[model samples]
Target: MLWLDLEGAVNVRDVGGIPTDDGEKIARGRLLRSDNLQNLSPTDINFLVENVRLSTVVDLRSPAEVTSEGPAPLTRIDRVLHVNHSLLPEHGFAATAEALLVRRKREEERYPGDPSCAHYLGYVEHRPDSIVAALRAVNRSAGAALVHCAAGKDRTGVVVAFALTVAGARREDIIRDYAATGERLDRILDRLRRSPTYAGSIDSVPEDHHRPRAETMEAFLEQVDKRHGGVLSVLGGNGFTDDEFDALHRKLRR
Candidate 1:
C-alpha cells in the first residue's frame, strides 16, 4: 500500500502495487482507500480529481453521518459518482460508527478472544446485501474507485481485504495492507479527535486500543475461510459472481 500524502485525510492510500499470488502486481491510481473525506481541501480535491482521476467515492458511513457531517466537497462534483453506501446497521441514529468500534472492543475485552473479528465478519454475514451493493459500485466505476469509512480501518479494511483476496493478492500482503493503517495511527486519531461526530467516543478509549493489528485481520480472514470457504465464497453467496469480481479486478488492475 502506497500512502497518499493528503492534507485532509490521514489514512488515504493507493492499494496498488501489491503483488498477487500469480506474480503480477495490482495497478496504481485505480483502487484507493481512505478515511473521512469530509475535510478535503481545494488542493486535495484538485489532486484527487485531476491527478488521481478519482471517479467514484464509495462512502461506507451511514445516512446520519452524511447529514451530520454536511456536504463534502466530493459530493458536489458532478463528474464523480458518489456512492454513499453505508454498510452500517439500519437500527437508528444512536449507533454511530465510532460507538460501534468501542463497543466491539469492550465485547472483545469481556472475553479472551477477539469479538472485533466477528464485527468484521458481520459485514459479510449480516450485511451481504450492502456488501454486494458496494462491490457493484466498485465494479461499475469508469475510473478509480476510492473506498472509505470513518478511520478507514475496520469497514474499509474488510472491504479492501476481500477485494484484494478476490483479485488474487497474497494472504500476507492483505494482512500487511490492513496493518499498514497503524503507521498513520497518530495522525488518524488526531483527525478523528477534531471531529464532533467522533471526538467524544474516541476520547473515552485508550489510543493503544485503536491500533489495527495484523492478527486481528488474519483472524477475520481465517474465519471467512473456515466458515464461509474463503473470500470468493463470501462474495458468491452474496450474489457477486466470478464475472462481477473480474470486472472489479479489471477496474483495480492495470
Candidate 2:
C-alpha cells in the first residue's frame, strides 16, 4: 500500500501513514485521492483497473462539469457514482474560477483564504448529501476506491477529509493529503487540457483554474476547523450516522 506516482495523475496519494491521536496509522492504498481522470493515460487506467483493483471511482463534480468534461471510462468496476455538489458559487465552476483568478491579480488577494473559499466549504457543510452519497459508494465497494474531481483539492479535498475523519485519521495527515495537490499541479493540468472546457478563453475561466495549490487547500481545511470544529461535526450535523462512522473506521483502518 503505497501511493503510486502515476505519470499523468495529480495529487494522487495513498491516504495512509499519518499518526492518529491514538497512535494508529491509516491503511495505505485502501483509499486514494486525485484530480479528474478525464485524460488518464491508457496505461494509467490499466494500472488502476488491473493492478490496483479499484472497485469504485466517486466523482464529486456537478452534472454540467461532468457533461462538459467526460471522465475516463471504467471497466467492470461495480459502479461509478455521480454526486453533484458545487464547491464554488451557484453559477458553477466557470464563474467561480474567473472570480478567483481576478482576486489573484489584486495585491493581497490569495485563494484558499479568500471569502469565496469559505462559501465553497459552506456549501459542503450545509449540503452534504452529495458527499455522503460518495461515501456510501465507498462503503459498498468491494476493494480499493479512488475518488476525484477537477484538481482534486477543494471539493475532493473536503470529502476526502471527511472520509479520513470518519476512518479516524489525524488532522495533520488530512492536511498533508490536501497539501499534496500542489506537488501534482502540472500532472493535473495536463489532464485538464484534454477537456473541452480547458480550451476556453481566459475571460471564461480563472488563471489559477488549472492549479489547485496547497495554500488554498490549507485555507479550505482551516475553514472546516473554524466553522464546524471538525469534519465529524460536519458529517454528524449533515446526517451521517454513528454506524456509518464505525463502519468507515473498520473498513479503512485495517
Candidate 3:
C-alpha cells in the first residue's frame, strides 16, 4: 500500500515517520528515493517539480549509465548532483560485462570469490561516500530531494538504509523500505536485460542472469553488517558529526 505520486519514476517513496534515535520520526516528503527518472512521464515530472517541491537530485549510478540513459528531461529543481557509484558501472554494452568482472574480482578478494557476496558486500563498503554526499545535499536543500540509481535498489538502498538507521528507524522498518523494490523493479530490469547494451555485454549468459534476486538483497544487508560494522559506523566514518547526526534525527523525525 506504500506509494508515491511521481508519474514516470517507479520506486519513489518518502522516508518520513520512520523512527530515529531518541524516539523521533523522520519527516515524510522531505527525502525521496527512486530509480532513474530518465523516462518519467510529463505529468509525473510536473507533479514532482510543482508538488513534491524537490530542490535537488542525487544520482548514484555510474558515469556510463548517465551518458547512455541520460536523466529525466524535466526538473523544475535547479541542481542535480551526479556522483555515480563506481560499483554500478554505467549501463552499456561493453561496460556491463567489464563492470561485472571487476565486481567478481573484488568479491573474490573479500569473500574468497563468492559472486553473490562479492556483488553485495563491495557496494556496502564503498557506498558511504555517496550516502554522505546525498545527506549533505539534503541537509542543505530548502525543500524536497530525491536520490536514485538505475534500479533504485542497490546503491540507493544502502543510502536509504543508512539514513533510516541514523534517524532511528527500526531494522524491520529499514528492511521494509528496501523490500518495497520487489514490486517495482521488474520493468526497469526487463528493459535493461533486453537492450543490446546489456545483451551484448554477456555472451552466453541468459537474460535472467543479469537481474538481481531476493537472495541478493538479503546478502547485501548481511554484508553491510559484516563489513561496515553496521550502518552507524559507516555513517560516522563518512564524516557524520555527532551534532549533525542529532540534527538529522531532529529534522527527519517528528
Candidate 4:
C-alpha cells in the first residue's frame, strides 16, 4: 500500500516493495512515510501499530513545531518509541533578518529555478546530524519505522531518499517515491491549512507552489551526488559506519 487511505493522514504511504539497484526489492513492513499524525483516529493508530507493526516514529519536526503541535496520538502507545531529530536550522522559521537574507542567497545559489529543491538541500546542509539520527532510529526500530514531517514531502523525502540509497534502491524509484506525494498534494495542503501551526505557511503560498515535481527531487539527488558524493557518502561522512549500513541493507532487502 504505497498510498494509504487514512481518515486523519492525507499522505501516508509504505516505503517498501520498491526495486533496488541490483534488482532486489525492499521488504514490506520495514518503513513508512507520512504527513502529521496529530489527529490520527483510533482506527488509524490500530492499523499502523497492529497491521503495520510500527514500533518507532522518527519525527522530523523542529522543537518549535513539536511544542506548537503538542503530543501526537502515538504518545500514549506503550510500545511505540518516539524520536525527534529536527532537520531544520537552529533559528528555523524564527531566523533573524540577517539570517533570512543569508538563507535566501544560499537558496538561490543552490537551485535558482526551484526554491523547493533548495529547501530539500537545506535539510542536509543545515542539520546533517538530524538526518543521521533519524536513519539510526529507523535502523534501530524493533518493528517498522515511520518517518514524517508536517507534509511528509521535503524533510521526510530527503531522509527516506538517503535510506533508500543505503538500501541500494534504484535512483528513479527514489525520485518516483518523492513525486508520488504529488498525487495527494491537494489533500496534504488542505490538511496543513487546517493546522494552526502550519496553515500560515500553507496559505501564504499558492497551491501549485507546494506541488511536488519529479524534477525537484531529481535535481536534489543530482546536487547530492555532485556535492556530497551521493547519499551513501553523506551517511558515511556523518559517522554512520559501513557496518551500520550493512545492517540496514540486510533489514531492508527482500
- lDDT string, candidate 3, 220-252, tens digits: 666777777877777788797887788666556
lDDT of each candidate versus the true structure: 0.83, 0.66, 0.65, 0.88
- The most accurate candidate by TM-score is 4
TM-score of each: 0.92, 0.78, 0.78, 0.94
Better of 1 and 4 by TM-score: 4
- For 55-147, candidate 4 gives per-residue lDDT tens digits of 999999988888988999998999999999999888755424455456667887877998888988888788999999999998999999999
Q: How many residue pairs clash in each candidate?
A: 0, 0, 13, 0
Q: Which stretches of candidate 2 lie over 4 Å from their true place?
A: 75-91, 95-116, 201-219
TM-score of 3: 0.78
- Candidate 1 positional error at 24, Å: 0.6
Off by over 4 Å in 3: 19-24, 75-94, 98-102, 108-117, 193-223
Q: State the displacement of the C-alpha of residue 232, model 3, in Å, after optimal TM-score superposition.
A: 2.0
Question: Where does candidate 1 clash, by residue pair?
Answer: none
- Candidate 2, residues 14-37, lDDT tens digits: the string is 676766667888876577777777
